[model samples]
Target chain A: MYRLKATFIKEFKLLSVDKTGITILFIMPVFLVFIMTLIQQQAYKSMSQSGVPVLLVNRDRDSLGTAVERGFSNFPVAQLTVDHGERYPNEDAIRKEITNGKYTVALYIPANATKILEQNVEEIMGRMFNKGQIANNTKVDIGIIIDPTANKPMVIAITSRLKQYLADVKTGVLFNIMGSKIAGMMHAEIKGGMPQEDIFSYKENYAFRDNRSSYQPDAVQHNIPAWAIFSIFFIVLPLGGGIINERSEGLFIRMRTLPGSYLSLLSGKLLAYFFIALIQFLLVILLGVYVLPLVGLPVLHIGSNIVPLVLLTVVLALAAVGYGLFIGTLFDTPQQSAVFGGISVLIMSALGGIWVPMNIMPEVMQKISSCSPLNWALRGYYELFIKGGGWPAIQTEVIKLSVFFIVCLAISYRIFQHKTNTN
Target chain B: MEGKACIKVRELSKQYKGSSYLAVNKLSFEIYEGEIFGLLGPNGAGKSTFLSMLSGLIKPTSGEAEIFDHKLTTDTELLKRIIGVVPQDIALYPTLSGRDNLLFIGRMYGLSEKELKDTVDKYLNRFGFEKNGSNAVKTYSGGMKRRINLIGGMLHNPKILLLDEPTVGMDVQARTSTMEFLNEVNEQTKMTIIYTSHDMEQANTFCDRVGIIDRGQILKLGTPDGLPASEGCKDLETLFLKLTGRKIRD
Candidate 1:
């Protein structure tokens, strides 16, 4: 116990003097969390939240054009711009606007669209009644010009939405023509031409498996946990480097002659590094909960209960410290451990969804992601923040992280023993 | 001063993995209690390998050795309490205070908190480090750093201390002071000291007896003053070069 305490004190003193190590352990993580969250928030706004801009040149000057113009105006999926009673721009101007990326889409409606639709419907009905050929003979093509530089997926989605809206507009115009013709033939009075109220509507909901209104994931929700897990795993840099420093400096030579197991010395150092890991974790969480909101990003929602999160953080710290001990024991030189530990953590972070979210990764990568210890830790955080889960939801991650800690520690001890024996 | 034999070795050998031959082969020697014994050798001469075997840092392939009835192989953990090793490198933590370094090492040797504090205080003054004990070791000079390194091993006060090139890199004054301090400690505690050095003259003057080894076997062993005359050399250095050869190992 004394040895452990001594080791802790020694590490604390050494770390206190190491400005670079302290910065990496504490300040860099907080800074990274803030920077990454802000960057991803902008990406989220551009990709998902903000509507695509669409410029409309409606030429019909009647109900069909007005309806089409109104359909896109202030739409959640698109922002529509249409000038009333203004000179219509030519195809060249519309193409130029789209080409310059002034708008993602430029739509044109032909002149007399309502009249053409009404004529087509009446002629088709009359032709059928007279036992003649029936067809949409009169042409009224709705033109769509798209920006070449626009994202293909976003353009495809917006275009698909535009097509559905146009089809509905055409159906409404045809229905109005048919209704008025029927009313005139029966000599009946029908107030209001083809009721403007929608016959059908769709409302999409964000739901849990139980269909509860689940919280939406923003950049803060995703990045905070990811960067937190990344920072925790980064403990290996200082921890492993410390061991290598001791060995290279000949401290290990003196230590080997001490009358106790190396674990006694290591436990204190592990606890010290674990303390640093906890601070790093808390800094990230605090930045997520407090600083991110101040920066105008969405507030990080850590669910209602923090008990499971706290438990998981402890276990995650252990896993990180264990991994650090293993790396430290395996390498003989500081430079070797630093390079390997730094690069390996980065790779783990990449695989663990720290750099990219798991849901966005390819199917094969998602499966491989589960193999990273950082992923296990991040999953626990996801349960707390995104899933709004308790202990049971994160039980698997907790178990996996715990087992990883044990395995790393066992390997570290065996390696340390082997080294001491070889010495 | 002569005393009863406290360290005994017979047919001790260590053949490291992948090595062609034994690093310490069929060695036999005994070190008496309270004697400053110097083990000398050039590079790759098995001095370190032999020291490692005696200190229980590494296992000997074939060996039977005893220190106060503690077997080298079987009672290694028990022997650790009785043995101390000071490496050639400056092992003290540079960022930590010299006092903190000693106290931590003392604690690792299972010294209680009060014992650690008291022993560290006493040793800092003994090594003339009290004035600079609170300062970080990195702030200390090379000699000061060397002093703290030496103090780290002595904090536990083991019965037998194995020093590998303890005074190799110090200036003349620092080296003289360090040797004088060790002599004072040896006279005061009657602790058996087994050290290695390239400084043949210092070893001749300080050590009661000396052994020059090469290729894992003892080439010569006798009292320091008696060794040179036995080899018809003017001094220990001349005799050492003659036995170990003039060719540079590096």
Candidate 2:
């Protein structure tokens, strides 16, 4: 225990005195989080106030196609612009416009859309009139052409609104036909052909509600945890470089002559780095929750389940420290460790959805993200913030992170032991 | 001051796993308590390798060594408590103050907080760096770093001190002070000092007994005064050149 304490104190003191290291580990993370949140907040505010640009290509000059275009125009958040096939000439030209980034999303109403709708409506009316049912065989496909590089949330919002509009139109038409048929039957049953006061009444109702308390999808909630985890893992570069420096300077060889095992030495260093990770995590959280809010950014929400948060932080720190130790032990020089550690963190962060949300990524990329420890940590944070999940909700992530920590630490210990013994 | 052997080597050998040549091969020797023993050799003469084996930094391939009746291979923990090793390089943390570095190393040796503070202060004063000890080691001169490195090893007050080229790359004044301080410590504390060096002149004047080594084997071992007479040379350097051949080792 004393040896571990000594090692920890030594490492902590050394790191604390390194101005560049401290800046990279702590200041840089907070700064990045602040910058990202500010930028995203501005972007979201602009999107809400100015609305997203959507191009409507109504090739079919029929009632159904006009209804679809009218639905898009009615949406308050969509800045609808209509291209009546005269400006773009054809479907290929419209697709090229979207691909060229002139518009974020373009909706193409196919030529037979009205014909299909009319057939379906006639079939429903025919069934109500005691006639044989008509088989509506025409397939109407509404082609939603979207720019692949557009902001994901904006594209999804536009697409979903368009789908909702189509569903509403179809349902309203069916309800009108059914209501007319029922009214006619009621009038026949009534003695005076249905009094004016007894006329049928129709209403449409829809609502959306969230049960989770204090739930707001803001940039702070996402960027805070994301950049924090990214920075925590980035400690690998400095920690590994420190170890390599010590080894090259012969301090490690001198340490072997001390009355302690290699495990004790490694434990001490790990303990110090773990605490550093914890401090960094807390500082970033505080910055997001308090500091950013003072500058008009949205406040970050922390869940009530503090235990899960602490556990996840510890496990993640262990994994990071273990990775650093492994790199330090495996590499012979500080330069090698720095290069490999830096590049590895960047790649892992990219794959882990730190730079982009996993849900927005392609299916294959999302699956690949699950293999990154950063992904596991981000998922845990998302559960706490977005899903309002408690301890039980993050058990899977916690277990996976713990397993990663153990595996990395074990491998690091073995390599360090081998290196120390051989030297 | 003759006494029971403080360190005993029994056919100790080390051949790196892939290397064809043995770094230290079938070497055997003993240094009595309170003796200043110098292991003299050229670069790559296995001087550092031999010192490393004694300090328990590396395992011997064929044989073993014992310090104060404790076998180095099996009783490393016990041996560590009694041996202070000063490596050939400046191993102290460059970012830390000299005092802090010493205190840290002292704690690793299990010194209490109070004892560590006092020991660090004492060493700083002894080395005449009390005023500048608080400065980071990176800011110190080469000689100052060497001094702090030596002080770090002996802070625990171990019975055996193993130094590998402790005074390398020092100016004449720095070398003289370091040698004098080492000699004074040996005489006052009756500490067994075993050092390896390439400077034959310092070895001749400072060590009570010297062993001349070459290619992993000790060519001659005796009192510095006696070895030259036996080799029919004017001095220890002449004797070394005569025995090891005048070829420069890379």
Candidate 3:
């Protein structure tokens, strides 16, 4: 026990005095967190400040004998001006506006829209020919021209909405005018039947209240916090590698021979590195909660679930250190141990949902991630913040992470013992 | 004669796994307290393997060793506490200051900070390492780095020091000063020092008793002057050549 204690103390001494080690442990995490937070804040702020812009121009005459514009006049969109009444504007003007890149969609409504609507045949044909540049050999040609330079998503959105409006009007007319005609046709078809049933009328007779509303739940919408949490969580690599360095340096050998057992020595190094990992965690969380908020990524949501998330991260840190110990024992060289240790952590994080959002991953990947410590880490945070889960909600994830911690430590102990035997 | 054997090896043998050759075969020897013992041999002679086993850096495959009547196999901790090891290969941290390396090693032996600091400072000054004490070891000259390495292992005042070629690759002045310093420590503190070296003259002058070993066997064990002179053999070198029947080259 004394030998192990000596080993632990010697490990601490080496860690404390090593300039390279101190910088890696203390400076790297904080620096990376600060840089990551700054970059995320900048991105989030830029996204929030911008909106899609669209323009519409119309020359069609309405039934009131006044020119009707293509879009609503009070529509809350920037650069939504109509073409000049007396001036003839070419397609270049519309292209120029789109080319300026501010407007996402620009619409051009042809003149004499009333002429085409005067006849139902022309109106029906206009649906297929508008924006298509097809020949219409009738009273007059009417069309809505769309700028080719506009974004495809914006164009799709505008066209879909316009089609919906037209479809709605056509449906209203069909239901009102064809209802009685359709009833007569149905009666003729069912002439031999005992009775004819009107499904719509029957549904109307059994009236019921509608109590549904659309509300999009966008909790944890800003990505800055997510980025901060993830970047901070990766500090496990360097911290674990630091312990491995001590082992490779023969500090463990020295300490193990110092009248103490290996357990005490292992415990001391574990506790020292654990405390350091905790400090790293706290620095990142404090920055995420207090400092990141100042840059428009305020604590969007840190519900009661945060406790489990933080605890789970700490557990993962322990697991990472255990992995370091395993690598240290398996490899004799510090460089080799660092390489294997880094790759293992990266694989875990990738599978655990650190690299990609879990919801978008395939079902198989999601299931696989659940077994990863990184996955538990992300879930612990997501539940507390995004899902607003309480302790009970995160208990399962916490338990899994704790199990990972225990398993890792067991593996580490076995490998170290084996190495000592061989030595 | 303190009546205490600093090191006692009996029927010690080591056969590495997967190899038929015995690195150290049935080696047995003893060194009294306050004496310098040299295990001399050529390359592949198993001198290092034997030294490592005695230093508790490794366990022997067969038989065992005793240092100061403490069974090495069972009481390794007690043995390690009194023994300092200066490995043949440089073990100092290349990136750490010389002083920091000494302090780090001193602390491992449970020395108080103030005492370690004073001891390190005194040793560094004596070894001409004080001025460059804060310089990284890798930046120092080979001889300077060797001095730091030696001081690092000895900072805790261990009763027995085990060195594997402590003066190899050093200049004549550096080698001479190092031997002189070892002689001073052996006389002043009565520290039992065992070193492995191929340099016949250095071993002849520095060691009280030299064991000329080859192929895992000790051919001769006696004081430098006690070596059997032969065929116009005038000194330790000629006697060693005639005894081992092999010239020191390589």
Which of candidates 1 and 2 is the stronger one according to lDDT?
2
Residue by residue across B1-250, what tens digits does model 1's lDDT show?
A: 5679999988899998878888888999899999999999998889998888887778889978989878898999899888888888888888889998888898788788898899889888877886889999899888888888888878888888888988766788888888998999889998889999888878989999999999999999999888899989999999999999999985
Per-residue lDDT tens digits of candidate 3, residues A172-243?
A: 434433454445657743233222243454322211122212312132222433444344444445545555
| Candidate 3 CA-lDDT value | 0.65
Could you say which candidate leads in TM-score? 1
Off by over 4 Å in 3: A1-49, A53-269, A300-310, A331-347, A413-423, B1-3, B228-232, B243-250
Per-model CA lDDT versus the true structure: 0.84, 0.85, 0.65
lDDT of 2 by residue, B222-241 (tens): 98898999879999999998
- List, for all models, the DockQ compared with the true complex: 0.72, 0.72, 0.23
Candidate 3 matches the true fold with a TM-score of 0.76
Write out the backbone clash pairs for model 1: none
- In Å, residue B95's CA in model 1 sits off its true spot by 2.9
TM-score of chain A of each: 0.83, 0.74, 0.64
lDDT of 1 by residue, A34-149 (tens): 88888878865766666778878888878778777776764666767784426455778788778777889878887787788777777877786567775669777878888877
DockQ of 1: 0.72
Give the docking tier of candidate 2: medium
